[model samples]
Target: MTKNNLVFETLPLYNKQSLEELLKNRINQLGDFSFEDDKWYYSKKNDNPLRKEDFIVNFYQVPIQYKNELKYYALLSTGLPRVIRTKCNKISQFLKFIDKTYLELTIAEITRSHVNAYEYQLRLKNSATYVKQGYYAAIQDFFMKLTDFDDTPNTVPTKNINPFRYIKEKSKRKPIPKKVIRSWDRVMKDQDIPIPLEFRTFYWLIRSFPNRISELLSMRRDCLKSFYSEYLIQIPTTKQSGGFIQEEIKTIPVAYSGHGKYVINLIQQLQEQTEELLLKNNIEEDIRTDFLFIVQQWGFKNNGDKPSVRYYDQIFHLKKHKINALFKQLAEILDFRDDLNQLIIPTSHQFRHNAVTDRAYAVGYTMEQIRRLTGHKNEVMPKHYTHQLIEKHKEIHLGIENLRSSNVSPVEFRGKIMNLDERTTKQLSRDPRRYLTWEANGKKGVGICSDITGCNPKGTSVHFECYACDWFVPKLEYLKDYKAEYEYWMDVVDRTSGDTKRAAHFENAIRNVSYLERILKICKNGIEHFKEEKLQEQLDKFNTPPVWE
Candidate 1:
């Protein structure tokens, strides 16, 4: 019989107990085997001279060729427990298939033909891709170790060679629909996704800093620094191919988005609130170094002084579970589909997509600018979110004057007009106090300040609420005809402005409003004429002012 030459974590089954115990147990138990550690080994009980071959059968000898197979399997199994278990079960089944022929055959007899036959057998019961790929993966570690062991001069399995490729499964690509892309932003805005601040910061940081989730989660609080009058966050060290890379980069600027200021304000608010809460509970603020998300635990010792904040690991494993739950909730609220199980959730990762779409692509940032911000380095921009592919094509100036009619009064306008979506309008309605201040420019001194400020030139039309030049004027003189209204506004502008620039600004605004009013009148007449029967109903529903008004 072949001598056992493999290492085991525990004593070999054949050497673990007396042979008499194994033979007695075997004879008394109908030739069934009993393993010591629920594995592939047992000793038959017998003190009597037993054949060496029978002992070999009972020993379940680990062949020298397969010596490092289990170890390699274990090495590959780290950090991917699910895949390891799946591969282990599949490999066990395949081993049973090979056992029928090999019994004790030398490892050299294994060939491509034998593997191909096994592949055919697998195809009969499973997908070709699954059988060929899954089985190959299951046996890859064994072959890799076999070849490595064979290279060593002292190794017994010198002739054994590996026979597996390093390639993996290929998948087809599909373009993401614009509807789905837009839905992501809408869903986030409308839903109540209560992600903890640490997770929320990490989520945005991952996409904004373009940091990996694992690396971000593993970071220490000491890695962050807040400098006076600085709008940038400096991360000291980040994981890379060559260990930690030392570099300083501005993450998100506080200039345009206002998110950076908001975050700082929010953190200060949280700190103040937490300290107040602690004081009320008679706890020290010094004991608040725990994860930002954790709440303190309170218990009674009959004297009412048992409040404590328990230390918890910051690398909470709730990301997948929480994201999936939010996706389910959002899908239900949006009436997206009856069964969410069939679709992937619009998760926090999709926020990365939104940033790319809205900020990088839609807002006219160059590809190079996007790459710098996204940290894509040299990788090609994904076709799913390239500006050319993602942006909706439009001739900006063709209907530039249409915007004025978008907010016309109920009586003056009768047609359907395109207004900004709720999210866009809400963002545009922010106070312009911080960015710029406006001054009136009209003959009667009648003007109103713009409600917001920002400048992203969308072709000829730029949405900016310049506080220094904001002014309001009444609608056209005649709702049906605007020649008189245009003349009146032109005269008003000519009489009041101190310079051509101011006069031109007032004239341009009045002309825009006049064109928009005419366009809206045409739209209203069309709607009233086309659908005369439902016109009154539509008007009553949409145009009716509030009861309080």
Candidate 2:
């Protein structure tokens, strides 16, 4: 993969602007600040509403040769307040590294050798590839993006190749385990859990919508809408094209039930609280200040740990670190542990991975269709995650206690055979929505109903009869249920005797037993055919363990 090839982390937008034009623009204006000065105290930007530190860049902190180049990229790359601060901070580290390497060096004097040495030092100090790559990113952007202007030397040798690709390492980020998420969901919705609405609602949004924390954190107060019968959220495409090239709005339709519905009510409550606090403080909520996360603080201030004083307790911008702190508190309460039996620290992005992977499971979705759910710039990740999910099945902790259909995936089991793969299932089914939760057979999730309408006929023996239906998908976890039902049909067949009516009823019972046996065989075939470790682990997750164990 090329540098910034992941496309999720950063967008290279300054390719259209040469180094010369940006330098001129930097001296003219960046929002309200003219960056020609030595130091800047910038607190607000037009685009992003999230709370962040001042984007103060003291050019004198870096040697003169690199100062203007840093200024050019920072100004042109972003207007988002937090990102502007991040660019300044990450690029500053690179400049500091250069200062120690050579007593004095001009920007033009810097070559690939200097960059290679810097990268070597980063690798030596940090084992994580993404962490090291992050430090080099701004510098890479500086060299790769700058164009020569007379009186300005922009001839860094590292400019030729993509900085992101140069790192040549994959991101270690993977989906958080589904079991942990289910636990988190249970805790998040509890009324007595004492999780502040700000953190709970914030996390709920991440769980419901697959997006980066940055995008959700900057969510506007007016983000929600009632589109006819459905409710949609106007998520700011904050990370689109690296948060600068073009600003777009993505509409995510929220479910009418579950946490989806709860979040809408929560947002409304937060908005009202924000309005009340603003009125009490004699402040007006404007576009810049109207945000969902920023609300009246009750328990220690939302941004920090300090208790809120009566007059001072007003809506505050919930910082990114504050959310991190909140999750740690929740994790501690839940006593969430990994396979190693170690305490697991949860993160905001963990929810996004699970959300994306779950959406990708809909076999009817194309790579392009999945991108809409992922908010990804390219279709690459939608395809990448399918294989990644199968590879990382072990790292994912699924429940062995419950035989819920959520743990069973017939689509995956079918995909093992060439003729009955996910692609083939899509071709065979007329409906775009092929999978629906089946809650019959005296259980919440016994199996999957491919066509719920066709299978459930009035007054018919639809319970065990589903085994014979073309649309019904038998879950491996429900193997015990199948056996029990088969016994019931067999008992009925043996008991019945006498005339033609009784014989016909006995024949139907025998037919039911045959269907159940066929389903049992299909489940057995799946176990034998998919002996692969990944598929086995998934099958083992929900199967009822032996009674002795």
Candidate 3:
């Protein structure tokens, strides 16, 4: 994949006439802002100067030849700060590659061979399929649009691959542990605890609902509204709301009891607190309009100044880092750690994962219902966890049915830590094998223990066993969780290697991987998805060393 070796003769000869037209359009396109400036900013109105920050991109690093053309591609494309910044940066990498390889070559000179070379470099530097796509697609997008007015619709020889969130990081997401949640629950209510009042409110609010920190940050002062017997909170979402729809409202229902009641109370308290701050006059100009959060600000110049604050800055607290930092501060205070004695730094996203898995484990929820809250436009969900409760409530109201999501009937075991319906109670008199899924009604239960007595009696390893066990009944509805688990364990299999005492770990990995594959088959296709009869026989196929090979 070199420039002179020219592997692709498919691209039509360089059309100078087309280049002139494209450059003309770009020149007119950039009239909203001066090209002389080294930095570009994003604003609701392009006329307004974007506040100087890394929220957008800095064009100062991009080379002179490709800067305007790259800007044309991005400015007309996605306007998201995080997205545009990354796209611009990746395109800059392409231009830099061109600078190194060819003499004063512009973006137009870069062809299939150059792109393949750059994509090869991406493969060397990155491992995640989606991460490579995230970088490669940017340059592809640039060329795709740059030649839009050319003779053909096809720009680069490369084709676009849709990056999948489920294939990437979502599968690895696990709910925050019950021990940690219980500890935090106790600590949050203690008046004497060192946690900030606002942070405590943030924790409770986020914990109560499956929501992102961004959605919470942009919540209106008048978000909570009572409808009939229940309450709904209006959440402004822009994560993937395309076109002229800058935002859309995603409402989550909250009944007036249990955590829902607590959540409702805490939100009112926060509103009252921030309302007092609304008296201040120095609000930041570009703060999200009528949002819930408003914090007093101090710049680098105020390092040694007194803690007294006269006004609130109305600054946007949409970024996750600040909330994550607060969580870290709390984690350190709680001295939180796992069985491995590893310290845990809980973030806002884990709560969302918990909410998703909780709903997914039960058959009452549908994929469409769950997708509403996750704030994604096309992905399977962040929505499911978001809307799981609404659908769960309907199931509880109708009473449990003999439900099935596949050929193998799923006994919807009320997950421990389950919090959807406050009305569901444990059936103490029922036999373990006879149980159908019941509502949690707010009572916590982990996924059903098939042992009828206790866990770990079979001597099975502690990781992902339920996913592989014959008693582990899976179905179509729980496919998202399975996919995530499958992707996660695959990564674990890739990382597994051992010799002496560590041989136990290898054996366990093989067992878990084989079973997960079987379970996934049962989940997707039906109960009749196997040929091998025994666990030992299934385990035989994984006996090869260099597991990745």
What are the per-model C-alpha RMSD values against the true structure?
A: 31.5, 22.3, 19.6
RMSD of 3: 19.6
lDDT of 2 by residue, 286-380 (tens): 43477667655443333243222223445567766767776775566557776677777777877776655543222122344446546887744
Off by over 4 Å in 1: 1-68, 76-79, 106-117, 123-126, 151-223, 226-258, 261-318, 327-345, 360-549
Best by lDDT: 2
Tens digits of per-residue lDDT for model 3 on 50-100?
Answer: 444534566877888777676656545534555677788888887788788
Name the candidate that leads on TM-score.
3
At residue 419, candidate 2 shows an lDDT of 20
lDDT of 1 by residue, 421-530 (tens): 44323322231112222222222211122222112111111221221111221222233333444455446544422222232243234333343334345446544544
Error of 1 at 465 (Å): 46
Provide the TM-score for each candidate, comma-separated.
0.35, 0.46, 0.48
TM for candidate 1 is 0.35
TM-score-wise, the better of 1 and 3 is 3
Better of 2 and 3 by TM-score: 3
Error of 2 at 375 (Å): 31
Taken over the whole model, the C-alpha lDDT of each candidate is 0.35, 0.54, 0.51
Report the C-alpha displacement of residue 488, candidate 2, in angstroms. 47
